[model samples]
Target: MSSDPLPSFPFLNPGEFRSICSSFVNRVTGYSGDLRTLGWTNVKQDYQDGSAMLIISRIIDLPQWANGEQNDEGSCLQDDIEDDDPEMLIRPSSISGTSKVEMEYHILLSPTYQVPVLHFFFKNTLYSGPNALEIVYEHLVPPAYRSDLKQVGVMGGISMTNHPISGIPVYFIHPCNTASALQTVQGKEAPTAETYLPLWLGLIGNCVGLYIPKELFASLRNNSDD
Candidate 1:
């Protein structure tokens, strides 16, 4: 981790971080890239305020443990979606994980701050409550981030919510102002790939029962041109 700010985000811009995720998802799923750059910044999530949010997101394949019948394909949203749009980008349907095991990742950035938020949605499953989240927080995340989830609107912290949409519940995990959580190997205080990516993959992957070694992220670090 460098003394410089946000060693985690190579370009210090959310867009670049978005591309990094795009590349990572691509490598893991082997699917045609469907990453979407959201149009609005004020997109609402539980326990969050409307702010300058630059978000890049996508819905990808789920872990096998997220067992359930895959939902039927959504009706064509061509009329509602933008041209060249890989997926629907309008209405609540703009997000694809309805009544199924949808793995959605959102990389969020704010103009007023440098550290970004790591947010994801685990939708349409039985794991939709504070109890489930407690199991994850206590077992998966490090002690430093164990308390982060309780701070919903804090600048550099984390939060969790089990909110339902149209009676369909989803589990949401949000890590805000992530720079504050990055502690280096040498006992330095900095946010770098050495720290951020492992923590992100660990907590999120554990909830889905996926194993993601930090070494697997080498592709993302090398593919900066994306």
Candidate 2:
């Protein structure tokens, strides 16, 4: 979260959804890397928890505003003194900090939900399982996607829940609009693929402040026609 260049989100079709996922990774604002495929329907990517997926940008020189925000500096100093790691020089005069927090994200196909489930995990990062979920709620997942109304037996909202397959805690966001859009493929009278899936994904991207180009509409249109 303290990274200089922060990140953003978005996606989908049946076969067309695959193409949308590809575009999202390559066309995202401030990022232009290819995501590696993990399975037939899963795309995997990593982002620096504090930077651009690898490096951590530390606040070498503390700012005045930060002083007020981190008013517990005295306690932090005491803790630092207790640790006494010489490599971590934490003093009033100078503080050289390093953080290499990395996180991996997955857009997984959910056969049950009939949509893609947004899931992510952090390694060597400050956020724990629940903390990561909160970050996704506050920074990544949109409010509308969350619902207090239980669909089956569970609650809604971005949840830090366990992935059914891996049994690991992760930040998860549900794709609420995927069902109706996918229905179009079955010859159902629902929103066209071009009209919904890419737009929904683009909204996800925009929520994360990613620049999903308007040209995406053109592509979505092309796919829907087929």
Query: Whose lDDT is greatest here?
Result: 2
**Residues 1-226 of candidate 1: C-alpha lDDT, one tens digit per residue:** 2213344442256444444344344443432232232111122222124333322222334223323222234322222121333322211213333242334434444344444444444433333333445534543345554454456422233345322222222344443433443332223543343334445444443333333533344544444224
lDDT of 1 at 121: 42
The lDDT, on a scale of 0 to 1, for candidate 1 is 0.37
Each model's lDDT: 0.37, 0.38
Error of 2 at 203 (Å): 4.6
The runs of at least 3 residues in candidate 1 whose Cα sits more than 4 Å from the true structure, single-residue gaps closed, are: 1-11, 26-104, 129-132, 135-158, 161-177, 183-211, 214-226
Task: Give the clashing pairs for model 2.
Answer: 8-208, 9-204, 9-205, 10-205, 11-201, 13-17, 47-53, 48-53
Question: Each candidate: RMSD to true structure?
Answer: 11.9, 13.0
lDDT of 2 by residue, 92-146 (tens): 3333443333345555555566456655554333234342344444443345443
Best by TM-score: 2
Q: How many backbone clashes does candidate 1 have?
A: 0
State TM-scores per candidate. 0.39, 0.40
